[model samples]
Target: MTLDVALSHRFKDFALDVAFEAPAGVTVLFGRSGSGKTTVANALAGLLRPQSGRASINGTVLFDTAAGVWLPPHLRRVGYVFQEGRLFPHLTVRRNLLYGRWFARGAADGASFERVVRLLGLEHLLARRPGALSGGEKQRVALGRALLSRPQLLLMDEPLAALDEARKAEILPYLERIRDQTEVPILYVSHSVAEVARLATTVVALDRGRVVRAGPAAAVLSDPEAVPTLGVREAGAMLVGRVVRHHPDGLTEVALSAGPIFMPRLEVEPGVSLRIRIEAKDVIVARGRPEGLSALNILPAEVATVRRGAGGGVIVQFRAGQDLLLARVTRRSADALELIPGAACHLVMKSVAVAQADIGEVAQAD
Candidate 1:
């Protein structure tokens, strides 16, 4: 399913005018606070009617101001997951999930319930109440409930925003499962670059009520021109690698298109595909392959693009094998190294540079 949205709304001081098309899979609406991310989600969910706009899923128009069509919130098959789980405090997990069936309009079947429970790993928590669940567990329950609703689209508005790091870590895998396993398209709103890197198949980056960038996750994240919008500290590239083997010295080896890269040991077995985020600031560029460097990962690359930042740094993109990697270097260094598109170079990165939190399992099709 593809989500097409064109919305215009005016608040007392803020005017939101944005439009974008999101393809199937997890399409993340990313930006800083007050960028109209939630506003778009609300518009699509029928929670808020924009002064003038149009929204549709695969040509099924939910609202079209020009045509005088407006579907009420209940009529729009959108399942919304908020920042908090917002599950009923008194209801058992089973009941909370079943509550969604009430809105399914008899479209959901017994197999749907079983599928959702298993997809979210909720079987063990069925009889427990929300009061007894951890924050991650609660969110998983909430996701199961949403899935059980049998919505055509899912809107997640910073579903991990309320959780601490530990809880966020715990729920991320389950989100990955939903993205890969279900046919439901998702419009996820988040300010987190880590979440975008890990989960997004397509990224629509908004800035102050307008779309600044929109494309596949890899292209958008690897673009140096998006640095200012993505936040300098958060800008990075996503690399997909397959686990080759675990070494005896407590390191895991993964095969990237650029060749073999080593990182801190991962718990997954060999041959499992993983998505790894490589922060631009953590990379170093060399004119040639250095022989004495301690970095475990060094790949031959060619400069893809070079963009100078407002400050003293330059964001350089490199085509490392089939993937693009980024590096932030000083303006002087970039000039001294003659970093330009098509220029030959090498990317140097240490094994420990990849954080455990930045590593995620690649969603697989069943």
Candidate 2:
């Protein structure tokens, strides 16, 4: 399913005008606070009606101002997962999930309650109430509830924003499972670059009520031109690889298209595909493959683009085998090394620089 959205709305203090196409898989609406991310999600879910706009899922128009069509929230087959679980305080987990299933009474592809519970690992908590679950567990039940509605699209508005790091970590894998296992397309709103890197198949970057960038996650994340909009500190590149083996020294070897790279141990088994995020700030560019370095991962690459930032830093994009990676270097360092398009260099990354949170299992191929 493809989500096409074009909206224009006027508020007392802000005017929102944005348009983007979200293809199948998780399409993340990313930006800083007050960038209209939630506004877009609300528009899609029929919670807000823009002054003039059109929204459609695979040609099924939910709203078209020009045509005078507007589907109410209950009539739109779009499941919404808010930042809070918003589960019933008096109901058991089973009942709360069933409430969503009730809306799918006549749907042809309503999700099975048992399958939803298993998919979210909610079997153990089914008999418990919302008060008995942790933040992550509550979110899982919320997700299961959303899935059970059998919506054609899912709208998630910073579902992880309210959680601390530990809770966020706990729920990320389940979100990945939903992205991989379900056919429903998702419009996820988030300000977190890490979440975008780990879960987004496509990214639509918004800035102050407008779309600044939109494309595949890899292309958008690695684009040097997008560094300013994505926040220089949060800019990064993603690499997809398969687990090769685990070493006794407490490291896991993953084979990237560029070559083999080692990182802190991962719990996943050998041959499992993984997506790794390498932040531009965490990378060091060397003109030559340096020896005697503390870093364990180094890949040969050719400079693809170099753009100077407002400050003294320069964002450099380089191609390593089939993948592109990003590096943020000082202007002085870039000039010293003569970094330019086609210039050869090596990306030096410390094995420990890759945080456990930045590594995620890639969606299984269909």
Candidate 3:
């Protein structure tokens, strides 16, 4: 299903105007707080009506201001997952999950009760109540609850915002499984680049109250010009790799477009595929492979674009193998190297630069 949104809503202090189309995949509504992301989510959920334009899913009109069409929240059939796991405190896991299907009107969804239980690893917790579950388990239950509703689209408004790093780590793999296995497309809202890097197939970036950039996740996240919206320190490139082997030296090898990358050992078994982020600031560019360097990884790269940002700094985009890589250097460095589009260079990155938090399990949309 394609979610087409052209909405305009106004508060006393802020006005929102945006338009975008999200196809049958995970399309992330990404931006900072109060950047109209929640407004878009609310509009799609039928909780907020816009003053102009309309919204629809796969040609099914949910709201059209001019035509006086407005579907109530219940009638919209969109499942929403909030920051907190709003599971019923009084019910067991099985009962709480069944409550979700009670409102489902059509055929079973991409997320059925049995499938969700398996996908979320809730088999052992069926008899347990919410209070007995851990934070990560609760969020997974909440996600399952939303999915079991059989909605056409899922709205996750910073679903991991309330969880700490450890809880986030425990739950992210399940999200990856959901994105890859489910037929239902998700409309996820998040500000964390790590989450976006991990789960989003498409990224719809918002700034202030307007749509800034919207396109495939690979292209948008790798674009040098997107640094302003992505935040300078957070801007990075995403690379997909397959776990080839684990070495005895406490390093796991991943095969990517740029040969292989060796990093700290990963707990996942071999052959598991994953995506990782390389922050722009952590990369160094060299004209040739350096003689002696502490960084063990170096990939052949070609310049794609050079974006000069504030504070005399420059963001250089390069095509490293089939994937993209980014480096943040000063204008002086770029000038000295005579960097321009299509210029060949080498990308130097330390194995440790790829943080544990920066790596995410692959979620290939069907």
Candidate 4:
């Protein structure tokens, strides 16, 4: 699946004009609230008519104002998953999922009912109604329903926003299963950087309704220059490594471009390659090898770029082998520490600062 979008729409206080394309994987619409992530998604869903532009999936035009082509939402064969579960109040979970099957339109290659039910862990709640299911369960059912509809494209508008942290965690891996195991190209709208990092194959970043950046998720998220607005502190980097071993002290060691890093134990086994995300804000740069620091991971890095921001702050980019790291500090700190481009520094980071959202199996979609 491929998505090509060039859209322009006007509101009372803001005008949205943006264009980008996504391939056969999850393409994330990332920005703060009211930045038009949802607006673009709606336009793609055929729910909102753009003043003038073309939107298409794999050469089939979904909307074209100039050509007077507009496909109804149902005919487009796109599945929608909203923030809330939107499950039928009076129907059982099985019934709701079966409801999506009616839209197959002879394309019965629809995701298997039993396969989807197991993938989403919806077996236990099959007999329950939407009102009786937990937040996470309902969302799982929502996902199952969408998959059963045999959609060529899936649109998710902050599908995890209404849930709490624990609930969000619950559904994220199932989404990963959807992305990796299924071929549906998903257009996902989100404001959470962590969510995008873990789930997106391609990222389309928006700022005030304009596209600030659009590229591979790892490439765009790892750029040192994007830290401040991206909400990275001491700004670390993303590293691809494999689990080497687990120790009795509740630590897991993984090899990186620089060296091996140890963190709280993970469930993964040796030889299983993993992507780990480290925050720049969580890193402490040292002028020399410190003797007694409690930090476990230290790597030599050369300062790449130093840019100044408002409020007497500086953003420094670092290159540690293949990994890109970022650090933000007071202008005074940079001067006193003698930090500059090409200077050698030790990046000291604690592994515990990494959250589950920062890491996942690196997606292979282009």
Candidate 5:
């Protein structure tokens, strides 16, 4: 296994008993505010020792309480990025980045100084202090510093939660580059469904310190039962598609398993395969194919299941070829349209509604 984790910890009213295995790519710990996502991450990084359990990555044991084996944070060779940049205000950006080199273990820092600077687009700000850069830029510097240490695994805890929308947008692409280009695996933590859908190869869902679900991003995100827990508005399906063509009218054609889907123009070049997260609320269900609709996407699908919301709505699951899509509607609409399991229906989606933040690599959203 690329990563193995199984532990039990207790603190006041909360008890965390979670077990999961995440491969070499990005694995996310996703859930609500107090779900122990951060706790799991900290434990893995050796920042928080678990009462009893074992954690190993690529055959190296980081911790084993029963066996009395525990590696210190520095020896664990794990890099951490916190919610805030936490860069040294007194040090120049270049020096801040170089500081990480001191803790680098046996390996020649896997990434070079110039390469790290270029990867994060931090060359221009190299002479400045932490106080001089924007929130996004500061985070980028923090990330560069962490990367310079040449860690075997990376742990990021809500790195974008403190940024505004525009700042968040600015830092996303750099993260995507890190996810795609680097060999190091990432163990990220976040509560946002949109974040999980875009960045995670595998998702471990937690609730009040307990792991509720764990699987590939596409499978876990499309599950109707997992939607409510993730958040009704954030619940959705993730589809992996490639950019076939770009239209002059601000739209990009994505060839998916079901059919060609057209969405707002993306910044990626043709032939780039990207993951798009379609929110359940944004999807509409029609008993039959509708004509003259403003929505550009209308794919034929068969109803797979119908679920009731905690309030007063119905959540419908549709199978579009190999991909699954979801639509949220009122109970009255289901009855009026006679929507049932295995019923043929058309799923309509609007192009403009798809958030750019929800597209591209997993790290972009997380």
Candidate 6:
């Protein structure tokens, strides 16, 4: 359940040097474009060779320059889902998926075609061609094709980059299913903060081809110092909660460490756990529990750290119960409230501010 990576390569202008260990869940290579995120993915997939590096999955060495261990692409047994589907337009979906079997080096090790199709919800569209499918469907097919190959590790290079917001929304749940239901580890690349918030169990932050931050998703994302590189407004907190109940008036109540949180109704049953992403910009810091506020969520918290941003804003890290919450507030507002380390306050936000795409349901075990 461990994937280790260390790569160093010299390019014309950019150089890639990174080392990190990704656990069993989805590990994201997160950064802006041209930050060597894809280079790492490519190195892992055997598409590009690093001048010096070592990669291993579950103790199986994929490449190690010092050891002269260089397994070719086919021998790597890594599944790749590119930005485009890359499916054969001439072939039906079923045939395209079956094409992955041609590269199977061994018995596929119990990864059958039926199980993959069922997992990806590709049953109905199996008879169609790539040209007739939607962007989301095409990507799902691509994922299935990769899964059918029975990869030791899955490499996804911005698989959702080609999709619109709607399309991304449609396919995210399926990817979540893969992350929770499957045993194979995933190396996913993305620049979207929303996607990283929802999909990443481990995050490797890259900047100018350097590994700036690499750790659990909660620890890396909650640090205000890292927000400047990730984008100030995009900084946020990921909170775990369980569905309490669905009200008849169209609001869903989720019990968090802070307290009960009310949000726009989610179409899910009670007792379901979720990871809720609340943007730092969306949180309002209140000096005390105030009245007459229209915001639906008011959580009592203690300020832990306040880091000034590049602009007029400041990133306020606070503790709400056992969870850490981040708020982006103007310096003037922070001064007005005299916010500082260990200051007691309350965080506020409207229920509707939580977009559907920002919430990820935790898949239950079998």
Best model per lDDT: 2
| Candidate 5 or 2, higher TM-score | 2
lDDT of 4 by residue, 156-181 (tens): 99999999999998898899889888
lDDT (Cα atoms) of all candidates against the true structure: 0.91, 0.92, 0.89, 0.84, 0.87, 0.90
Two-way lDDT contest, 4 vs 6, winner: 6
Q: Ranking by lDDT, best first?
A: 2, 1, 6, 3, 5, 4
Candidate 5 pairs with clashing backbones? 198-362, 199-362
Error of 1 at 133 (Å): 1.5
Instruction: Report RMSD (Å) for each prediction in the order shown.
Output: 1.5, 1.0, 1.6, 2.0, 2.2, 1.4
Better of 5 and 6 by lDDT: 6
In model 5, which regions exceed 4 Å deviation?
361-366
What value does the lDDT take at residue 99 in candidate 1?
Answer: 96
List the pairs of residues colliding in candidate 4.
233-280, 233-281, 234-280, 234-281, 235-280, 235-281, 236-279, 236-280
Task: Report the C-alpha displacement of residue 286, candidate 5, in angstroms.
Answer: 0.9
lDDT of 2 by residue, 107-200 (tens): 9995699988988999889899999999999999999999999999988999999999999999999999899887888989999989998899
TM-score of each: 0.97, 0.98, 0.96, 0.94, 0.95, 0.97
- Candidate 4 local Cα displacement, residue 54, angstroms: 0.9
Question: Largest TM-score belongs to which candidate?
Answer: 2
Each candidate: how many clashes? Answer: 0, 0, 0, 8, 2, 0
> How much does candidate 4 score in TM-score?
0.94
Q: What is the C-alpha lDDT profile of model 1 across 30-62, one tens digit per residue?
A: 999999999999899988889998989988899
> In candidate 3, which residue pairs get closer than 3 Å at backbone N, Cα or C atoms, i.e. clash?
none
RMSD of 3: 1.6
lDDT for each residue of candidate 5 in 1-366, tens digit (9 for 90 to 100): 399999999998899999999987889899999899899999988889999999999999999998999999888889999999999999999999999776775687488889988898988999999988999999999899889889999999999899998998888788878887788799989988877876788999998888788898898888888876688877789988878999988889998888998987888788888889898889888888999998999899999989987677988889998899888899999888888898999999988778988887433333
